[model samples]
Target: MSTQMIFDYVIVGAGSAGCVLANRLSAEEQNRVCLLEAGPKDRSPLISIPVGIGELLPGTRYNLHHHTTPQKHLNDRKLFWPRGRTLGGSSSINAMVYIRGNSDDYDAWEAEGNPGWGWKGLLPYFLMSEGNERGTDAHHSGYGPLSVSDLKWKTRSGHAFLRAAESLGHRPNNDFNGSQQNGVGFYQVTQRRGRRCSAATAYLHPVSSRSNLHVRTNSQVARIILRGEKATGVELLDGTKILANKEVILSAGAIQSPQLLMLSGIGDQDQLRKSGVTSQAHLPGVGKNLQDHLDIIQVVEASEAVSFSEALWPKLLTAMRLPELIFLNKGPLTSNVAEAGGFASSSLAGGNPDIQFHMTAVPTFQHGFNKRTCYGYSLHACALRPKSRGEITLDSTDPRKLPRIEPNYLSEPEDLQVMVEAFEMAQDILAQEELSRYKKKSLRPEQKLSDRESIIHYIRQHAESIYHPIGTCRMGSDELAVVDSELKVHGVDGLRVVDASIMPTLISGNTNAPVIAIAEKAAELIMQRSSRSFVKENRHTQEVE
Candidate 1:
C-alpha cells in the first residue's frame, strides 16, 4: 500500500552545501543522489540581481525570515534573521561578498581538535571551489565552478569610505582573501559579470540535466528515518518516505540541521521526550553552541547626491537602468549593497581584526526593510567573534513549525565591550578628513557620542544581526560536539551534517565562501570512502573467483 524510492545518497536541504553535494556526489553515473529543498524553484528576477538583496531581505517568498526570541541582554529586543529558503540558500539572497575569513580563524579550528579544517589543511578545497576572475595565484584558482569577480560598478560614497579608513591608518588591500585580512578596501563578490553566482547557479543548475541526480523542490523534510542508531533515510512533510542506500546528509543549515536531529529523536533525551520524539541517540550537543555576529549600523547623510537612495525615489532612473544591467551588466542595480567593507582590529583582538566594517552607499535601516528617503551612506560594524553563545530548541512536535532561536546576543560582558569599542573605532574613521567632503550629518545617533557608556547605550537600542548564524551543530572531539572531525554525527551511523551549523566557531567574515569550501571537503571525504569500499569489494570478488 506504500511506495518508496531509494537513492545512493539522500541530501536534505538543497541549499548552499546541498547543491554542492548533489553536483559532486552524482558525478559518477553509478551513484544516484537526491536533493530535497523546502522552497520553490529559484525563479525570482530579484534573486539574480546583485543589488536585489534589499528587495529579498524582508520578503518571505524565497526567504525564511526568522526572528530570534527577545534577548535578555540589549534591553530585551528581538532581532531579525533572514535566511534564504530557496535553491541557493542564503548565498542567493545575501550581499554576495566573497570573503573566506582569516587564516588564523581556520588555524584555531585545527587547534580545537578539528583536523583537516585549518586553513593550511583546507586551502586546496578553497582554491578548488573558487573561479576567481583575478586568475590563478598562490591563494586563488581560476578554473572552479564558483565565480568570483570585482564590482563592475563602484559608488563614489563607497570609495570615499575606503579613503577615510586609510586616513585612519588602515592599509588598503585589494583582496581580503589574500595573505592578510586586516585592511580596508572594496570586496570581491560571488558574481559573474554583474549577476549573482550563488551555489545553485554555480553547482546545481549546470548539472540539472544529469539523470543520476534528482532535485526535488518545495519538499520539506520532516525528519531523518533512523534504524536503531543508523540513519536510513528521511520522511517528507507529505508523508512520502525516501530511503538512502548509502548515506543521508543533513545540510539544512545552522538552525534546521539541529532541529531535524532533535525531531528525529537524536538529541538530548530529556528534550526529545518533551518534544514527543522517542529518544534513539543522546547527543546533548544537537542544538547547543549557537553563535552569530552582532552588527550595529551608523548612518551619515551625504553632502553630495551620491547614494542608491536617489535611484529609488526618481523611479524612472531605476527603470532606465534596467537595460544597462540586463545588457551591459553595469548600473546601480549591479551593486552588492554592502559595496565596500574591510576588516579591522579593536582593543578586543590581540592582533588580528575582531571587527568588520561594511560601507554601503545607501542609508539602510531595519535590515533594508525601511530605507530612508534621503541621499546618505551607512557604516555597518559587526563584532567578528562574539563570546556570547545561544541555542536552538524545538518549539513543538510539529516539524512544520519553526524552531525557537535564542542567540542570547551580548550575554557575555566582553561581547558588549568589543561592540562599544568597535562602535567608537568606526566613529573615528567616519570623522576622518578624507570622508569630510561627503559628510553632512550623523543620522542615527547624535554626532556627540564621545563617551563609552553613551555609545554602549546606543548600540544596545539600535544594533541588529548581520545574518551570520553558525555553530548550532559544532564539529569537534569534545563531549558537547555533535559531529566528529570527519563531520559525522556522533553516535549515529550513516549520518552527517555539512553546513554552517558544523562550524566549531564562527568565521571572521561573510560565511558563504567558507561554507562552499566546507562542502568541497565533504565531497572529497565521501568519495574517498566510496572508492575504498569499491576496491575492497573487488578484492573479495577476485579471491572468491
Candidate 2:
C-alpha cells in the first residue's frame, strides 16, 4: 500500500453532487479538495449527444447496469437499474429532463421535521444552479452553471402528444416548472447548444484548472475508514488510503451510498455481523426505506413514418441528420427521445398531480435495448408517490460486490390502483382526435383494456422503474433516518451523504434537477459550517498565545 495522503475534503463518486461539491468547496484556495470517481472521464462523443442515451442506457460502458433481486409483486422478475458510473454520473446517461418536481414535494419534506428543505428555502439554490435559455423569471435564472434549454429539434409525434393531452382538457402549459406544474408541455432539458450539459460539463470542467482541486478517476472506494464513530478517511480498492482532514462526502447516489455505509460497518449491528463485518454506528436505516417511481409504457403503431425507430428508413434519416447536428447543432439527433410530457392527478389523488407522463417518439422494448422494426410512439405514466417501500442489503462484506436490491414494487394495493388509473388516462389521451392522425393501433398491453383485471395484470408484467431511486439513506430526525436535515450521517462524525439517496421521499418528477439543487444547498451548509469552525479555531489559538 502507498503512503496515506491527506486532503481537507474527499468526495467519493465524481457524479452530479460530487462535481458540484468539488467546484464549490475548492473555490477557496485554502481548501484542498480531492474527488474520486470509480469510472473513467466523461469524454465519449456518445455522452455529448442527446440521442446517444439509446446506446448508453442499455450498455455497461458508461453504466453500472445494476439489477434488483427478483420482485415478488411483479411475477418474480428482476428489474434492470442502470446508473451512470462515469465522471458526470447519471446526468451523462439520463434523458436530460429539467424538472424540480412539485413545489409541494419540498414543503412536505419540511412538514416531516426537516427545516430549511421546503420549497421557499430550496428555490434560491435551484435558481443559483440553473442557466436557462429562456432567461430569468420568478422561478428561474439565466446565470448559473447548468444550462437548461428548449430542444433544438423535436419529433412531430411529440407535438401531437402535447396536443392530444390538451384536447382531453389537460390544459396546455408551456412551462412545467413555471407558476404551475400541472399541464402538458415540452420539457426543457439540461443542454447547451444542442449538446448534453451533464453536471461534469456544467460544474466540474469549468473549475478543473483550480490548483487546489484534485480529481482522480477509475478509483473505486472500498470503504470508509472510521476511528471510533468518526470518519477519518477512505480506503480505495487498490489498498491506498486518502485521509480527509475535514470531511468525507458520499455522492454515489441512492444505491451505493447506503451500501458504502453498510460495508464500512455503520448499518444494523445484526446485519453487519451476518456479513462478518464489525459494527460501528449500528444505524439500521442505512439501506432501508427504498423508494422509486415505477413506470408503465403504452406503445402505439404510427400510421405515418414520423417516429424515430430502428427501421431501415428511419435509421438512414437519422444518419443523414448527423451533419446538421455537427455543424448547426440542430437536427433530429438533438431530440431527447422523451421530448414532451405532462403532470395530472389520478382519480385517487388529492390536490397535486399524482401521475406524470413522458412521451417518446419511438417504441422502446425492454428499456430501449431491443430494436423495434415498426414505426411507433410510446407514452409512459408513473405514479408520483408510491406507498410501497423496499430495502437494500449486503450480499457479502466485499465492497466490490453489489448489494441485493429489492424495491418490492407494487406491494401496496393503493400503488397498484394509481397505476391502473394512470394506464387508463394514457389510453384516453391516445384515443383523442389530435392523435388519431398518427395512431394506427395499440401495440402494448396486448390485452383488452376494457377489463380492469387485465389492466392490473398488464401493469404487473410491464411496469419498470423510471430510473428514480431514492430514500435508502433518507434525511429526517426520525429513528429510521440515516442523515439529518443538514445531510450529516446520524451517529457519525466527519461524514455526510449528498445525493438523491438523502431524499426522504421521492419527488413528483424527474430526480436529476432536484439532486443538483440538493447539492447546491448542501454546498452552502458545508461552507457555513467550515467558516464557523475556522473562526472557533482561530479564537482558541489567540487565547492560548
Candidate 3:
C-alpha cells in the first residue's frame, strides 16, 4: 500500500525562494509544508567564507555544474554553467550583490499582465526581505528575514574604482536598491555580521528546527504529480510519492522549473513528444522565452599588489587568517569579489540602461575555481534588454540529467548591437583617469568600434552568460504562457511556479533580490489563497507579446 501524509504545500527546491516560501507558508502552524532540495546541507566552510566561494565550485560542496547544448552565437561552444545545489541555491555560491533592478523592470512585468509585479507593487516585499545595516524606512528596513548589509572589508581598490567612476562623471549613488539605480557605488551586499548572508543562512537556518515545516535535503523532485488535471503532489527521484492537500510549488529556479514542467508532461507538445514525455498539458511555451544576462568579462592587471590572485588558494595560505574571520567575521574571507556594480546606458539612448556592470576585485579564470594568477579586476557587462530567447529541454528521459539550455544568447541582431555598444561604452568608463591609475588593461580584443560588424564579431567571440537566467516558465496571459498572472500554472490546478522562471522578461539588474521579492510575493499570494475560497483569477483574454 502507498503511504501518504498530506501537506498543505509541497515546495520543491530549498533555494533562496524555496526557503522563503516554505518559511512563510508554514508560518500558519495549521498548514503542513515540506521543502525539498537535491543538494546536501550547506555546512561547507567555503560557502560562509565569501572569498572561499570560488574553491567551493569544481567540488560537490557548493556547486551543481550544468552545461548548455552548444550556443550558436558563442561559436557553437557549450557553456559550462554552475548553479548552487546547496540549501540556498545560487545565493549560497553567488557574489551576493543585492539588487532589485529598476522601477521600470517591475513596471514592465505589470505591463506584461502580471498586474501586481510592478516595482511599486513589489517594493514593500523587497523592503520586507531586506535588513539593511544602514537602515531606513523609506529606502530600506532593519527587520527582515534576509540580511542586507554593507561589507566591513572594503578594499582600497573597491573604493578607488567607485571614486574613479564618480570622478569620471558617472553619478555616485549611496544605494542601488534605493531611489535610483543609475549610479556607481560600493554595492550593498547580502551579508550578516561581515560573513556571506546566503539565503540558507538568512531564511533556512533560522527556521531549521521548525516542526511545522519539514525540510528535506538531498531529495530531488522529478516532477509534479498530477491527478487528472490538478497538481496533487510531486514524485521524488527515489520513486517516493508525496501527497499535498494544497499545492506543489516548483521553486527549482529558471532552468529547472521548466525542466520539471516538461518532465511532468506539462510542456510544449512537440518537444515533449520528441523526448518521449507524454503530454499532460499541451503548453507550447513551457520552456520558451528563456532569457539570461549574457556578459563579456575583461580582466585587468593590478597596479597595486593587493589581490587574491596570489594568496587565496592551496587552502593553507589563506587558512592562517581564518580565525580573524571566524570570530570577528572580517578580513579576506568576508568579501564577495564583485564588490561593486552599476547600471548605465550607452551614449546612444532609447530605453533604460542598455548596459549593466558587475566588477569583481580579484580575477581567477572568471566563473569557478581558478588558482591561476592575473588578478586585478574582472570587469563584466551585459545588455539589460535582450531580444534573444532560449529554451530548456530534457537531454533524455531522466530528470537527474541536466537539461539542454541554449540561451540563443545573441540570436537577435539588436542584442549584439547593444552589447557591442555597451562594450565600447565600458571601454570609455575604464579609460577614465582614475581607473587608468589603478591598473593596466589585460585583455583587449582587437575588435574596434569603427563598424558594427566587427564589434558584433568581438562580442560573439568574447561574450558568456552572467548566469542571470529567467523567463522559462513565463507568466503572462496567452495560450503559450505556462502560468497566469497569479503565477498559477495554466491548465493545471494546485500548482504554482514562483522563481526567476516566472519573469516574462529579464530585469535590468542582478536577478537575486528580484527573485527573493518574487518569492515573498508568491508566499503572500499562495497563503492568502490557501486561507480564503479560491476565486478563479480573471483570465486576461489578451495575447503574449
Candidate 4:
C-alpha cells in the first residue's frame, strides 16, 4: 500500500489471470507482489449462484459493461460487451461452462508462430489449476483450489439429448475430455458443491492473508509508466505512480489489454497520432486480428409432458425447491442451463471441427441477457474457427474512454456459410428418432429455414457473440504481431501481457479455462527466470568471496 516500498511485480487488473499470477509469483518468503483491480470486491451473492450470473450484469459492482463502436457488419448497432471487474474477472460472472477446448485447437497455435503453446506444452498448466470433480491424473488435478464438479442430477433434457444423439447414428461418449472431444455429452462445469467457482476463489482467496502480497481493489490503472524502453511501473488515475522492483505484467484482458497499450503510446504509429497519443512502439498488430464466437439460437416447440415449461409451473412451488438444492446439493437449481454440447467439423473436406453446439435449458435474447421464462429447449451453434478478423482501437487519448471494438462479425462470406451448416446440423439433431417423442411441430416453422437468402436474413437479425473474445494483442512471429511467444511486448522491455488477449488464435471452447491456464504457465515461466537470475547472482558473489 505504501509507495516507498518496491514490489517484485506490479500486476495490473486483479482478474482471472492476474489473481493466479499473484498467488504463484508471491508464494516465497521474501518476494513482494501488488495486485490492482479497477472494480470493487466480490461480496455479492448474485455472483456465486450459477443462475444468478444473469443479475451480475446491469450493475456497476460485477460488470464493467463496455460498449463497442457500432458494428458495420451488424447493421451499425453498437454491441454491449460485459467483462467482470471484480476480483475473479469474467470467470466470476460467466455461465460456468468449463472446457479445455479440443487439443487440436492448441496444436493449431503451434502451427502458427507460437510453438510452446501447443496441447502437450499447455496441458500441465491446465491440470495444475483444475481440481476435477472426477479425480486426478494427466488429464486433471485434484489439489488445486478451483472445483470442477458434476452438475445437479443430470437434467431430463440432458438424458433426452444423449438418447437422441444415439438414435441419430451419433455415438455417445461418457467423457468428452478423456480420450477425445468429438462426441455428444454433458458439459463439464466450473462448480463446487453446487455453487459457482470463480478464479478468485481458486487462486486468490488463500493467498489474500499473506503479508507479502497486497491486494488493492478499486485501483484504476491508466497506463504503463515507462523509462526509456522499460515498463517502470503503472500510473494511477490520481496521477500517483507505483514503480515496480522487477516487472509489470498486465492481465487486463482482450479489450483492455490493447486499450492500455494504445493509451500508453504503444500501437500503430499513424493510429496513435490520430488518437493524439505519442508513439512508444510502431507495432501495427497491437489491436488487430480480433476474433470472437458468434452464435445464433433456434427455439422450438416441445411436445407436452416433456418440456421444462410444465415442470417449472407454479413459481412459488419451484422456489421451495431451493432449500433442497442448497441442503442436498441435488436439483435443477445447480444446473448451468447449458448442460449438453457437441463439437463437429463444418468442412466436408475433413478438417478439424470448426463448429460447436450449445444446448440451453432456456431462451437467449439478441445479446446473451434474457428474461427468465418456461420455454422449450434452446440450441446454439457457433463457428469455432472463423475466417474473419477485426480490431480494437482507442477512441481517444483519455484513459476513461472505452475502446472501439470492431469484431467485424460475419465479415467474410465464409463466416456466414459456416453458420448455415450449423443450422442444418441443429435440425439434423432434432430429427433423430429419440427426440421425436418430444418434438412438437415447429413453433418457428414459418420462421424461414428454406432458402439461402432466408437463412442469411435470419442470421443478420439474430446472431450474437458467445462472450469469448480474444487475440486483440496476438502473439506470433508475423510482422503485424504485437508480442512474441514469450508474452513480451515487441518493442518494450520489462512489460508482458498474460491474458486471453495474447492468444495467437481462438481456442475451440470456452475461453475461461484457457485464460486461467495461460496465467498459470506464465507465472511458472516468470518465476523460473527470476530464480535463475538469483542463482547467477549468488555464483558471482561466491567468485568475489
Candidate 5:
C-alpha cells in the first residue's frame, strides 16, 4: 500500500536553501523537481508580520523546539535551540537580520582547502540573491529575489544604542556589508514593505505555479533510498517512496542533514551499529565539527518608556494599531526587534571584528520566552568565531526521534577568555554617556562585574546561543570533511548537501544571508553540471543514430 513518485531532482527540506533550489532547478521546463517539507504550510499571520518572532520563538507551532544535551562546561545546562519547521524554515521564524559575516571568514574557508568559497568568489552569488532597497552598487544588487530593506520603524532605544557606541570611539557605519565592517549602526532586515520576506516568499511562492515543480508538505522523510553507494531518492515514514531520477539534495539544515545521512546507512560504522543501523559509507565525519555563536545579554532597566515591554502600553492602544499594520504597513509591528546592532573588535581579535552586537529595545530573557513586566533594554554580545566544537548524533534509528545535540560551549579555555572580553566591552558601551540618560540599573548580572573572575562567572551563568549553528556536515579537503568544495557527499554519488551545514567554518555574523547566497551558488553549479551531462547524452544519441 505504499505510493511511489519520481522527479529529476528531489530536494529534502523546504528551508532557505531548498526553496531556492526548487525555484532554480525547475526553471528548465524539462527538469522535474520535488521539494519535501516535514512541517505544515507557512500560512500563519504571525509569520508575515516582522515583529511576530516574539510569538513564534516561544512555541512549537512553527518551531522545531529542539534542545541540546547538557553542556559539561556551562554548569551542565541544556540550552533551547528553536528551528523553524514550516515552508520558510528558520527564515520564517528568525529576526530577519540581513548580515553577511566578515569577508575574512570566507577567505579562511578557501585557505582551509575550499576553493571557490572565498569572499572574492562568493560575492557575486550574494549580489545575485539580494534585492536591496538602497539600489545597486559594486557590493549590492537592487534586482534580486531576496528583499533587503531598512526597518520602517525603529525603537527610540535603538537610536541611543548606536550613539552610545559612537560616543565610545566606534565609528558609525551606515552599511555593515560595505567597505569596512567595524562600527555601530542599524541592521538591514529581510523584509519587503513591512512584511517578512523569507526564502519561501522571495523564491518559492512566485514559482509555485510551475508545472515542472511539485511541493509536498507534511512529508517527513524516514531515510534516503540508497542503491549501494549512490542515493536514488528517499522514503517517507508513512511507507511512501520518492525516487530521484538525477540527484538528491539535502538542505535540511545542520542538525538534520547528517541525521538523514546516518539514518540512510551513510555514517560512522561504529555509531551506526550502536544506533542499531547498518553502515554503508562509514564516513566518520558525518555529524562532526558542530559550531554555533554563544551569546550573552546585558539587560539594564530604562528610566523612560523606551523598551517594547507590553506592560508600558494600554490594552486599547495595542488593539488600535492593527489597522495601521494591515492597511498602511506602518506601525510598531514593522520593527524587527533586534533592530540596531554593530560589530566590534575585542582585545583578542586579529584585525577583523571578533565580537558582534545585537541591541534590543526589549528585555528578553531565555530567547524571549519569559515575558517581562518592566521597562528595560538588552545588549547581546556573541563571539563571532569560537574554538569550541560540538556535535549531533542519532538517539535512535527512528527518524521521528530527535538528534542528540551537544554544543559543548566554552570547552576551550580561549573561548571562555574571549567571552570575558566581549562581556567587558559590552559593559563599557552600555555605560557610555549617550545611553546613560536612559539607563537606570543593571538587571541580568544583578551586580557590578569588577574583574575577570566576576565577568567569567557572569558569562557562564548567563550565556546562550544567538541561533547561528553550522559545520555539522563540513565542506573541505580534510578526511573529516563530509562534503567537497562542490558540495557533493564524498563517497556517495548523486547526493549533495547545500545548506549552512556544508560551511567549512562559522562565518563572522548572522548566517541567514550567507545561507541564501550559498544556495544561489549551488543552483548555478548544479545547472552547469546538468548542462554538460545533457550535451554528452545528446552527442552519444546522435552518433548511435
Candidate 6:
C-alpha cells in the first residue's frame, strides 16, 4: 500500500487475464504478486445473476462504458463501447457466451511466425483452464477453474431460431468447440449452477486467502515506470510508486493496455511527444492494428407472449418466482439473454463460416437499453472477420482521460458488401417456418430491402459493435508488431502484455475464453523464466566460492 512496497510481479488491471495471472503466479508460495484494479470488488448482486447483464452493461460500476469517435463510414455515429472495469473485467459484464473462436484462428497466428500459438499448441492450455459440465474429452476438460455448462433456463424462441437455422440447410451441432465450428445450436455459458462464473469467481476469489497474493481494488495505475528500456514498476494516479522486482504484466483489456503503453511513453515517438509524455521506447505499433466485430440486428414482434420482454413479465410474477430461482436454480433468472446462435458461411467465406448469429429470446432496443413494450425476439448477425482497421490515439497526457478510439468501421469497401450479404442471410433464417409461427411483424428495416444499396443503407444506420475489440498491441514479426511470439514487448525487457490487445488479429467468436487461455500459457512462461533465473543465481554463488 505504500510507495516503497515492492513485488516480484505487479499485474496491472484485475480483469479476465489479470485474474488468471494472479492465481497462477501466486501459486508458488515464495513468489509475491500484486494485482491492482481501477474499480471496486465484484460484490454487486447484478454481477452474480446471469440475466443481470442487461443492467450491468448500460452504466454500472463494473463497466468502463467508453464511446468511440464518430465513424465516417457509419453515418458519423458515435458507437458506445463498453469494457468491464471490475475484478473480472469484461468477463463480469459480458453475455456469458463461451466461444473459443475457430481453430484456424490460432493456426493463422502460427502461420504469422508465432510458434506454439496454433490450435494444437494452445489446446492443452484450453483444456487445462476449462471445467465443462459435459465431462472430459479431446476438446474439453472437466476439472478446471472456469465452469462451462448448458443454459438452465430456456425460451421457446431460442429453440425456434435453431430450428429455423437448420431449415436454411445449416447442420445442427451441439458443440461449437468441437472439430468443426460451422453449425447452428445453443451457446454454452460460463456459469455454475445457474449463476455467473466470472474470472474473479473462477480463479481469484478461491485463492484470495493466499498470503503471497495481494489484490488492491479501486487503485488505478497511472503509468509504467521504465528505467531506461525496462519496465521496473508502475506509478499510481496518486503518485505512489510500487516497484516490480521481476516483471509487470498489463492485462487491462484491449483499450487500456495500449493506452497505458502510450501513457508510459512506449509508443510512437512523435505521438508521445505531442501528448506531452517523454519518450521511453519508440515502438510504432503500440496502438495500431485495432480490430473489433460489428453486428446488425433484426427484430420481429412475437405472435404469442412467449418472449422475455419487460411487458411479458409482470413485476409481481417475477417477484414471486424469486424463491424458485434461489432454491432450485431453475427459472427465468438464470437466462443469459443471447441464448442460441450459429455460424454460417456467407458468399465471401472461403473454407469456414464468415458470419455468426446470436438469437436472443427478448426484444432488444439499442443494445437492450430501450426495451420494447410488446413481446418480441431478435437475431444478430456479425462479420467474423473484417478488412477494415482502426487505431487508438492519445487524447491528453492525463492517465484518467480516455483515449480516442476510431474503429473506422466499413473503411474497406468489401466490408460493406459482406455486411449486405450477412443481412440477407439473417433475413432468410427468420422467415423459415420454424420461426414464422411466432413472428407477427418485422420491427426493423421496416420494409424488406432487396437491393444492395438499400441493404447497405440499412446497415450504416443500425450496425453496432458486438463488443469484441483486439489487435491494438499486436504480436507478430512484422515491422509494426508491438510484441514478439512470447508476448514480451519487442523493445523492452521485464514487461509483457497478456490481454486481447496483443492479438495479431481478431478471433472469430467471443474473446473471453481465448483471453483466459492466453494468460494460462503466459503464467507458464513466467514460471519458466523464474526457474532459469534461480539456477543462474546458484551457479554464480558456486563460482564466487
CA lDDT scores, all candidates in order:
0.88, 0.90, 0.79, 0.78, 0.89, 0.88
The per-candidate count of clashes, in order, stands at: 0, 0, 0, 0, 0, 0
**Residue-wise C-alpha lDDT for candidate 6, range 1-545, written one tens digit per residue:** 55667999999999999999999899889899999999999999799888888778786588887889999988999998999998998999999999999988999999999998999877877776788999888888777789999998888999888888888888998999988899999999999988999999999999999999999999899999998889999999888887899999999978999999999999999989988988889999989999999999999989896667676455346546767778998688888989999898877888988899999887787876787877788889999899899999999889889999999999998788778888998998988999989988899967678888888888999999999999999988788999888899988999999999988888989999999999988888888743334334434543575
Model 5 clash tally, residue pairs: 0
Structural similarity to truth (TM-score) of each candidate:
0.95, 0.96, 0.92, 0.91, 0.96, 0.95
User: In candidate 2, what are the lDDT values of residues 271-301, reduced to their tens digit?
Assistant: 9999888899989888999999999999988
Best by the lDDT measure = 2
Locate the minimum summed-lDDT window of 10 residues in model 2. 530-539
Worst 10 residues of 3 by lDDT: 534-543
lDDT of 1 at 134: 94
TM-score of 6: 0.95
Q: For candidate 3, what is the lDDT?
A: 0.79
Q: What TM-score should be assigned to candidate 5?
A: 0.96
Q: Least accurate stretch of 10 residues (summed lDDT) in model 4? A: 530-539
lDDT of 4 by residue, 32-65 (tens): 8999999898888677767665457556677888
- lDDT against true structure, model 5: 0.89
Of 1 and 5, the candidate ranking higher by lDDT: 5
For model 3, residues 409-525, the per-residue Cα lDDT tens digits are 888978877788777766666666666687755554532355767767767776877778899989899887888988999999999999999999988888889888888888888
